[model samples]
Target: MSLEIRIAASTDAEAACNVLRRSIRECCELDHKNDPAILDAWLGNKTPQMVANWFSSPTNFSLVAVSEGVVVGVALLTGAGKLALCYLLPEARGQGAGKALLARMEEQACSWGVKALQLHSTATGKDFFAQRGYTDAGMVRSPYGVETVFYWKQLDEDTTCPNAPKRKRFCNCNSD
Candidate 1:
């Protein structure tokens, strides 16, 4: 089935949060042997209030991929050009939904006049980001005892959307 991409609304908070939680769990399980308590702490810290704050924040932008009315993937962009909370359901992986969601987020960042984008990618997603022109910046150890690789991509000047405003600081709308 073809995936549909759209801007995420406040209504998507629960599904988006679920997707992120699952993604983190799956990725960590595949790569690490961390205890349940650490995993719970890392993913459990986000609450409904935080999700609401993300939706209301001006500096944050979120996008989702839906299939048959169900959200299968999500991505969030922050004012600092950081990409966060990017995830695709286990069933949705390897079917282009992830790439589509990422493209849209990059487009949004470009529209916001962001010069660069950064993210910390899991072992599973590291190659995916590298294939899309992101370079490794460093490695970060998670509180849950997992090590993630940091990556960054500098967008070309010509890729900036003409309609985006020139602003230094904006709202922080990151998820996860």
Candidate 2:
């Protein structure tokens, strides 16, 4: 089945939280290493309530990828140009969900006049972000003791809108 990407709503809190937790626990074995302590710390704040607050925040733009009526991916970008969250179910990887979500985030940042975006990527997501033009700024340890790669990307003045089925200028862009 095809994937549908759209803005996240407060109603999506539970499902989005589930996707985040599962993605971290199951797909990020490299980072958590099946350590219960690490897992707990990493997932401690991923509750539905916290996710609902994030979705309701005016300073954040959240997106979810849904497949077969289930949310399979979740991502959030803050107004300060921080990619706060980007997670996908193990089954959702490599199906363009991540790429689409990142592209939309970049476009939103550009619309807000943000020049650069920074994110801490787990081990499993390092290559994925790097391949999408994010460079390693450095390595940092998360609050949970997980080593994460700090990634930075400078967005172009005209960020392409990947949400469209065809590659075209975003609505606000001047058409050629």
TM-score of 1: 0.84
lDDT of every model, 2 decimals: 0.80, 0.90
* Candidate 2 residue spans exceeding 4 A from truth: 158-176
Index of the highest-lDDT prediction: 2
For residues 1-176, what per-residue lDDT tens digits would candidate 2 score against the true structure? 68898999999999999999999989999999999999999999999999999999999999999999999899999999999999998888999988989888888887777778999999999999999989899999999989999999987654443332333546876669
Quote the positional error of residue 119 for candidate 1 in Å. 0.6
Candidate 1 per-residue lDDT, tens place, 92-164, comes to 8898998898888888888877889999888889999999899998999866667889999987654434455
Cα error of candidate 1 at position 169, Å = 22
> Cα miss at 138, model 1 (Å)?
1.7
Clashes of each: 2, 0
Instruction: Give the worst 10-residue stretch by lDDT in candidate 1.
Output: 157-166
Count: clashes, candidate 1: 2
